[model samples]
Target: MGTIWTPKLNSYSGAKYLRLAQAAADAINQKELLANTKLPPQRRLADALGVTVGTVTRAYAVLEQRGYVYAKVGAGTFVRAEESEFKNKQINFATCQPPLTNQISVLSDAMSQLAKSPQRLTQLMAYHGEPLKEHQLIFSQWLHKRGITQQPEQIVFTHGAQQGIFAVLNGLMQAGDTLLCEGNCYPGIHTAAVQLGINIEPITLSDEGLDLSELEQKIIAHQPKVLYITPNNQNPTCIQYNLSQRQAILALTKKYNLVILEDDVNYCLSSEWHSPIWSIEQGSEQSEDPGHVIYLSSLSKVFCGGLRQGFLLVPNLYALKIKQAIHSQCWMISPLNTELACRVIQNPEFMGQREQVIAQRQQLCIEMGQRLGLKQRWRGLNGWLQLALPLKAHHVVTALAQKNILVRNGDDFNNHQNFIRLSIGDAADDKIFVQQLAIIEACIKSLSQTAYSVV
Candidate 1:
């Protein structure tokens, strides 16, 4: 199994894993690896390639997650049945998701710590108000940790950032009222707007962020009721907006009588961050309307998505309305996730682990993408390269699914199938994950047509 290659780092390059994974996938796609084809033992591949068993394990995990490959506990990993999608269509690259952190210890610790006080859990088992004081503190601390002190009272709780979004769009604008979003935008918000019968207007975007001149023109002409932005960590494209551009955006928010719905859902995973929209010191509140801006963020990006916890910061003026809308449905967020979140926030070790986990996943994501010769049509978390898909994001996503890997394509965030995303930190061990990446490369090679290309 001494599959030695040239250069030391070459063994670990993101391209290496990409190529290897693609090779494995191609073997299956070409039917060279038959239905239920059991993958070679991890040690065998590791020894064969003169690589660590961990690497092999990662590659296998990648394959398994993509649905192209699978493994039973004591049994060996194998390819799915030929009738399965992995055997059907090619792979899609348009999905965007961060790696899952398998922190059994963390979960166990949280459970144990919370178990000591079952009373707290029991107390919160019932419904709480829309603005849960507990969650607000957690959210405020989260923002403050990032150097933002925009007040907890200004924050309202929501099911997820998605719900916060619904409130922002719902509370600020009326049906038939126009709004502006990134030319390339978060599709979730786009869908919500369409569902509510609100008009969505797109503003052209640059790598730095939205084009200020164009944004200004749109604001001045249409005088949109609201401006939706993902400033801290822009999504789908995953670009970080620059300081100048962000400041300019704040200026426009004031000038045009515009309501700013800063949809900052991705702030948690952002490798790089911008000052929050609220922190921008436009003018004194007594002198002007700082109430024009609204901020939304979530715990889902940092913790489990099932946490079902998100927050909104509005000018005290709109807090009541937003809370009222939240009240009508789901009444208030489930107190269970809230108290658990509070417990998580109180745990000092949690923050340290979060940093470590994000960095590790970021590194893995970079290496995986690089080994495959994946190029960013744009950038990503922590200054990493984000590749633009060469096919319709949905097609690439579905294709990847056929391989057994679950991913979020651009269409999840945008109606357009143009962009696709891949994350290194998602799900995989070293070697097996590399193997899975190799499958993606194969899919890219064999799969064609809907090329959205790059910026």
Candidate 2:
């Protein structure tokens, strides 16, 4: 309908198909060809460029595979829509969230029901000094089902998991006290530590779990007040601690009389749903005084992240301190949001749908990784890609960004630069998902061949 599109492929050096594809990619990237613009018919373009129709077809296929354009059967190919300059369109491997399912409809229904109930709305408006008993009971039952048994009294509501992390650190540790954690741990731990003026000491992590010997050595040297861990699907690595590893870590907690801040936020996505480290610590016969582990988890990972609903199970000894810290921070977590989360959790069909969505996404990503020949490990929604020498995470990330794809570098999670953390959270559909991975593969191969370096 617009001007008949013609590409200048002389400056690009590659196979004829690749050169044509590269020209299209460059035009899209440079904004010469805006999103949703239709290309000329294959026969017309082939004649204009003095190339065969088959060449144009292959070139279009390449463009589609790389996510630059998409073809509609009997309708010709058109540029894929670009949502934002920063986010691009379909590929965003940066955030870790539950895959899209019926959550939005569920939330909408819940909101409508709430709007119809004036009394319930009024209740949510008032400030309750403590988390509601009914909500606590619901959460307590939820925890019990997951193998972490606790009284409803011990559970405290938090605005989100990050808040729970901060509350535990601030409630238990002083400004100068040291905290020991995985060398490459959740970035939130570092952020919270900086705010509270707490010192963090890194412990070496092995494939099994934390290097036990290194953990004890750091414990003795630093006399840390707390140990933070993600027992299931450790962030950026997806390494699940085996039973023996859990027992060993629990033993260290008892020996040093150190508190364990157990972060099992990714429990919803874990296929095994293993008993949390907190449960093991509590059930141990050797435990003379059993309140050593502080468990933190959230609905954000399982349901909708915007809900900002999280709950913590604290020991009696530290409950008041953590409660006071929470009060000081935000007064109280929004009761309306909490109510919405409770409704979502109560839905009989929600959990099954959530699981199905997550499984499909996880399988797709695993298969893609296998096909790409990339060394990878996946647990839940996150995948860890290990890059061999002559390939670096930052360079790959930068190259992908140029193509309008976003991903996280390993250094963002830890000091390591050889891995990339891919969160399959924002992908729109299976087609876009495969295309994004193909683009990632192409970027990695191109970088490796050129030995790209960033100075």
Which candidate gets the maximum TM-score versus the true structure?
2
lDDT (Cα, tens digit) per residue for candidate 2, span 41-75: 89888999999997787778767755678888888
Q: Write the per-residue lDDT of candidate 1 for residues 238-279, one digit (tens) a residue.
A: 667788887788777777777788877763444466667777
Model 2 alpha-carbon drift over 4 Å, by segment: 1-90, 267-270, 451-455
Residue 407, candidate 1: Cα error in Å is 4.7
Q: How many clashes would you count in candidate 1?
A: 65
Q: Model 1, 38: alpha-carbon shift in Å?
A: 22
Q: Which ten-residue region of model 1 has the weakest summed lDDT?
A: 1-10
Model 2 global lDDT (CA atoms, 0 to 1): 0.81
Predicted structure 1, TM vs. truth:
0.70
How much lDDT does each candidate structure score? Answer: 0.65, 0.81
Error of 1 at 205 (Å): 0.9
True-vs-predicted CA distance for residue 139, candidate 1, Å: 3.3
